[model samples]
Target: MNFYNIVRVSVVAALLGTSCLPAAAVSPPPARTSAVTNEDERLLALFRDDQRREQAIDPLGMLYRTGKSDPALLRQVFTDNPVRALNKSVKLSLSALKKIDRAKLSPERQISYDVFLYDKTEEAFWLRPDMLALTQVTPLDHFGGLHIQFPSLMAKGSAVSYDNVADYEDALAVDRAFPFVLDNAVVRFRQGLDSGVVTSRLTTANMIAQIDGLLAQPIEDSPFYSPVRDFPDTVPMSERTRLQKAYFAAIRDEIYPAYRRLRAFLNDEYLPAAREQVGILGMKGGPGLYRHLIEQQTTLPLEPEAIYQLGLSEVARIQREMDVVRKEMGYGEGDLRSFFDTMRSDPKFHPKTKEELANGFSAVGHRVDELVPLFFNHVPRTKLLIQPYPAYREKYEAGGSYNQGAPDGSRPGIFFYNTYDLPSRFLTGIDTLYLHEGAPGHHFQISLAQENTALPDFQRFGGNNAYVEGWALYAETLGYEMGFYKDPMQHWGTLDDEMLRAMRLVVDTGIHFKGWTRDQAIDYMLSNSGMGRSDATAEVERYIAWPGQALGYKIGALTIQRLRKKAETELGPKFDIRAFHDQVLMSGALPLPILEAKIDRWIASQKG
Candidate 1:
């Protein structure tokens, strides 16, 4: 999943909303009429109702998705009560969805019905009382926490537009609401502390540091103040001074204090109580939560051990491929460890300046654009922008991430490459990174779905990580077909990335299920790949903060790869790579089972 999309547990909880449902309580569809009773129309209406309810509960999210400012929505702060309401709404929607006879619906609506069921089921699982207790209580983390995401969300050209006077007012409302969200987080954390379901000490420390970083910034210099600094022509000149004062005051009085309060709480109380064991296995009811996360994330009933074993096997296989790349580079004599050392130390493999780093990614993107038609039949109409992460966010941010643009082409998709600790970052992986996070990866997958208005909003906007991240990981492999990995170092870079996903399978399970330490997980990552220490540490901690999420990349990619191989074998000369991709992507992100079934149907159609 893209970094920004992986929001805080609270953000997700708010997105899920207040509701209740028994597990597996969806009723079967009502009896159908042979004459066609307009079930598709009824289903479409239900989808529209669901979207309305979602906007009511998750206005901020809708603002991001649509790029339309709603002052009413922007004025509201996130609260747990809304999450409960959202749950009830989702349950009602699910029940209503099941009441429609699928047989009477059009084939297109049938696909929508299946995807809706899958999405609601997952939503219900996360919103369940027990599940919420385990997840929603410890909402903030160093990765994907509100403190980090809020700044990025409020930045210029982000989801929300800052174009007019009312737009600036909407931002002020949002700015004022942030403290309430932070306050709510404090309440949740305290509840977790009471219940003994607190975050890990490592995660807590990282979060405190993040909060401290935010607190240290001057009021006007804050990201929240960024909007005030740049008034557009549309924003009336008369309103500028007022908006600027309002923004600065909000940041100084509301935002900074909230950060400081949270920081103090973490350092004084939560830190002492935080668990040393970083894995979910150590917390109250953690193992069950981990198991649930595995199933939820991969959209399959996979055991941790099974995933771990798969990861191990994948790691070994990729290593062999790495050896081939090494040998081809005339490094037949030395061990991979030594070669990794050379790659790490070699100045040629690292960018000297941030500009050069940004240029490198832009070059990779342009090269992919030139070759995209050979592999993809569809490219998103929305433009893609490549730039380095802003300083405030770059510190703890992932190496690279893609934030999708507005569907109507109002905003361009952005691929933010990290320029932090530039020397530690590798240039070898630039091609693979661009392919995964930028073109034909997230930018393609997310933008295509958003732009396709024919699909229901849930199908267009909602997605499972297995298909989303899995498709991105699979996109990385196309580098080879496009000849981007001909250089042995570049080939190794792709393999190293593949190894990162494979190791996630093992290390994630090993930490949570097999009782691996944070250090052990980090060491395993460092030793197995050419990833720098900083990146390895951040990656491991991310898994700790969010269990079972990383599993999606390799697991999802493997499913897609296996299906593609099956399609190639079955269709022979009839197989069209572009068409197959369209089949996989055009439906939006699907659960693995649904995606596999869809591909199988496509293959049968090809055969006929």
Candidate 2:
């Protein structure tokens, strides 16, 4: 999953009751000339201007991407207010984009034009007043809520700089804004309460637990205080004392107090008012909102019922494959549930310690790196680190997640493995998980995009759930050709992971659209796969917190898989897997339709 997306995914999504915008032409355009060159330059210049203006308003976002933020802009905290500015920016950009004739540009420029238009038009829809009503009121959740991301952003391993005295003070300036962000969230929660559109009770409880964990940490151990605990050699000795004091003051006076206020509000006011039903379908504008999120997240015009049905079909097919794998593992003619039971109950399938888990993942990464050249022509130079989730955040996190590194390769991209409840975590999915979240998955897809200076900023940094997560899920299939899944247990692990994604399609749509209860979702996951109760519960809660997101993994992987099959069939033996991967990834993430178009164009070119 994209690190930056988690915090904002709950608050923003596609506009309800709207069809997708018509795509820009993807076929080869006329030959380039002085006129076309001028248009391309003008169009690119407009994109750059929009990015700069956006960065000006969102200094933290700018800092995350570029590792630099203006001191004057550091005080601007992230909030819902930017949606309005983004709406206006999209309108102006689209107007300017329409004036350029897409057919006059070269094919390369045409792809950029299509992606840019799709992105802005999609934003225009979501930023509408009606759409914002469904999102803005319910601001945070346990999964990707700002409460979780803020600390993670401030932690040592994250992407920002802490090189000198000025850097320390710039962080302080940003740290001061935490309280206001929390206050604004409370205001939004109150709005949700007034309108009877609050978050789910389960999610509210999860957020409360998460906040309580944060508040329980001592002042010195707080992630916000981490920066000053260890001073760099560049800082003068006299300044170190003051910096340490200021950092502690920020955490004590500003940060912890804000967290306590949020905790109290959630415990006292919001939790009671929060809905008992986990699904959004029970809320006032829920049905429309779920539809909007489904479209927004998957980048497809799929009805929830359609997704639910597709999920059912996928689950049955995967279970059949699981049955075959079960027989291969020396279990004779037993039901799939029995095999699942053994996998879950057998202590041998789990990690002995967190270090053991970390070592296992590191080994997988090393092996994958050795074979990287066999499939991918482009390998990211950005370092990938494997570490367990920090104590404060692990209980609520997923099995694993990837944080992007600096484009300049200063900080390494990290894949956080959840070692919470160590005995409950399985060793079965270790290699597949490593492939999905580490090398050639998020690390590859994200690092490659950002490292390529030749692409436009949007193509390099901007992304959608369908392409980003889908590419990662697709990356998991690469394990087969690489021979990682040769062991029957390992293959079962891959199937189990695949089953989780397939079940997400059913369960996510089931909860939000069909009103499946939280327990109901958990029971379904446990019955279908070897997932333990703890992992199953966490996955269900995640879907409850962020509906329609899990749907993208299976849907996206299927799309990429289908496109690859089409390319292979058409190109015959001439097809190069490396080139196919390059075509899919070289332009960064694209909407599924745009990606399909690009692949079709590549297929045609190869045929000639």
Candidate 3:
């Protein structure tokens, strides 16, 4: 989820299990004369049942926070028989979904029903035997590898709670299963080989590098040991010593051995068989697979060519805007490419050191914090923290990202900027980056949604790619209205980030659906924007690793922008920015079409 997770959410979750529903587990709703109200309680209870079942399958996800959960202290991450679970879970959920009478539901209930149906339908499409053949085999990739994610989970003061002795024991239990989880990935990879389903040699090489990086640290010096180095005084001395010994043993005996096994298999076998081709379309049943992935990510039935063209137009439009700023800076008359080259090479645009970059982002964050009230009526209670990406993941990650905090506000939301290559990190774009990854973007949207208790559990904690990233991208545009991008360079900085999203639309789709090579994507990006070769390469590889994902940011941002224009036009002077924003944010991460419908309803009501 780290890199591949950026703005995208899957419509089709690979839910699998062969269990029949227990309809009577939940009681029916209170009596209602209307058809909508009559079924709301009964159906919602069933919905809750299904959600809990899904959560139960993902115990590690459930225990991601620092403390207690419904099924507390469980350590295993992957669901049981995950590959086979897809068919079984989808068939059952889809069957259950079909039984619900959507026509009987009220407007609000109807939205819930439709959202559920959308997810189930997409899941049904992918779980079909042919498509599943393409997906089930390819269990791990460079971007979302557990090989990279698990250690972070085990690292001290992280997600897995270390508040109590039981928590410590739970950590051990989870650690014991780490080897099985890695071995399961191996099992899936072997299965993929039999079916001619293999990942790119490029991604495989990255995974190998990742595995080696994890192994490079000595057992005592490992991140997994960081959490235990200082136990709370509450933990008894003898028990603390026991945990210390057990952790060392787990790393030495269990965790390391599993990684070594995976590393050996990857280098010796997987690499040799890994495909030279990058896109998923080249694989067996890849056309259908790629199409479904696009649909699942974008929540629209858009063709790849249409999206590619949209990218080109957006890129051109943003470039024109950039030209205005360039001219203002007294460089517009000169060659556009040379100006871009200067921006790329100019040391003045970049931070001299990591601390300077961090402090710059923090300063921008402080300025934005004072400006939040001017734009929005609602601000999230959750705090935002700016930090650099960890040493291990910085190589694979983008320039910046955000991870949502606990809904309870127990954990502060973190905005991680990549400090991997310090010199290439630009100071001009820091304001835009902070806005996108921090307040009024991810922090505002994500925190507001998670904090809204009126929404259903899925809506609160769950998401869609369009509304989430779209809203964040849209938030950047608000910087101009809020007067933060007053500097010609700062305004261009926003445009610079906007151009990258536009480029993603072109490059991501081109690489995946149109058979554009990695270098083509990189070259196009370098030519169009101020991105250095390293940044271009990382972005292209990311698009390759996760197809159709980059399309979401621009596609989503445009949709929100269009909706705002419509609302302002229809409501005239009566349109309230506060209410309009609330209308968008209060319902959590709606699918784009659903979001549009809700905005239409809000507009009509405001007009009345």
Candidate 4:
């Protein structure tokens, strides 16, 4: 759900045995595109300028966001005033866009125009008084904030380059900037407090836990210190010593102190004020905020009550399927609650060691690779790497999430499997988990977009959650076709994952709209699904921290699935699986409505 944990190191190191250039350089540059028309050229120039600002605000985004087009960009750190600059950028982009006459432009330019205008408009919507009053004050959550993500970015062997003296120097600048990011975050939290907009007490505690973990570590062991742990041998010894000393100073003095202060701010100031209630509606502008988020995330006009009803239906439907999984085993099979308890407590269902759990993910990836040809022809050039979630991040994160690689296949796509709480982690779901997060899911969808230079940068890099997570959720169903769910146990896993998303719709809406308390939300999820208490609690907290986001997966997936059904019915014999997949993925991510329109157009064409 947190898109920040993505953008991995390039693939050159793993694939070729040695580095030819910095990983960024290995990714093929964005195709040399000239304007199709004078208007398009002008618009593209504007888009390019916008892209640079996009690159500036997001340091991790530079690779995929700009296709690593500017090496000088790599040398510069993240912008000083990101939130402010983003607001200004939206205003400027919108203003510039208004001067361009859409009627006069080529059809291609019109498409670009529509997408940008919609995107900028969506961004500007957040700047409205009701939205800003609710959102801008709470800059960081246990989930969506920079605090959890920044450490991972600067971690060794992650996205941030630590290959050379210049890389280290540039990274140091980014490292130094952390204090500002943290301090500004504090100011925002203070603003939220003043405006009667604060996050849940649970979220505040989790954030404090993360900060405390960081502070307790020695500077050398800190994730921030990871880059300097072992510098490239190419650097001079004297330089290495100096860099090491400087890194220690940066971590110990700058980074550590910032986290300490941030922790203090949360414990001493923020937590006492953090609302005991977990819903967005519990805040000053509750109803408006929840509505905006639903529209923004689901890319639909559906209301919370509607989504809540949809979730209940989905939960029931998934439960019936799970029932079949239970019946397939053919036993005394107690009531649904007891069945869920049986699944949870069964020793054979959970992995013993953390290594076994990780290996289970790899095995799933390998099995999925064998079945790919049955689904479609094209596959991502990127190899999928299965790794455990970094210890610091696992507590706050979901069971598994994917990080995309460079479009040119310079980086391997990483699937961070949560190996924390090994005993609580279920083995039955590992196959479905890998199928969703690894090769055929995010790896294929995200990589194919980035790899395709034929599309514009915005479509390639930009995404709507409904399309993005919808596609991933849709990917989970492919296991049914791939012969994975043939194993009754693995089949149960897929259903379990589906139930989690389905429950999210019910629970998320319940928390924010139906006035469900955090405990009540957690209980609802646990009562309905085979999810462990820790997993359920983390999930409930996630919905609380990032409301409406969890809906994207189920809402998007269902839409895509419905479109596919419509296509299959309309096209009849002409519904080529490969073509259908290409149509879905080729244009990259789209808003659900745009995606439906495009798919319908494709279906109509195929009908002939």
Error of 1 at 453 (Å): 0.4
* Winning model by lDDT: 2
lDDT of 2 at 340: 87
Instruction: Give the Å error, residue 36, model 2.
Output: 7.4
Global lDDT of each candidate: 0.80, 0.80, 0.73, 0.74
Backbone clash tally (model 3): 4
Q: Summarize candidate 3's per-residue lDDT along 169-255 as a digit string, tens digits.
A: 877777777687677678778878988888888888988998888799888778788767898877888898888999999889988
State how far residue 545 of model 4 sits from its true place (Å): 0.3
TM-score of 3: 0.92
Question: Which ranges in model 4 have alpha carbons more than 4 Å from their true place?
Answer: 2-39, 53-60, 63-85, 98-110
Can you give the TM-score per candidate against the true fold?
0.94, 0.94, 0.92, 0.91
Q: What is candidate 2's local distance difference test score? A: 0.80
Off by over 4 Å in 3: 1-36, 65-89
The alpha-carbon RMSD values of the candidates against the true structure, listed in the order shown, are: 4.1, 4.1, 4.0, 5.7
Ranking by lDDT: 2, 1, 4, 3
- Can you write out model 1's per-residue Cα lDDT over 73-132, one digit (the tens) per residue? 433444566777768888899889879999888766788889888877778777778887
Error of 1 at 196 (Å): 1.1
Q: Candidate 1: worst 10 consecutive residues by lDDT?
A: 18-27
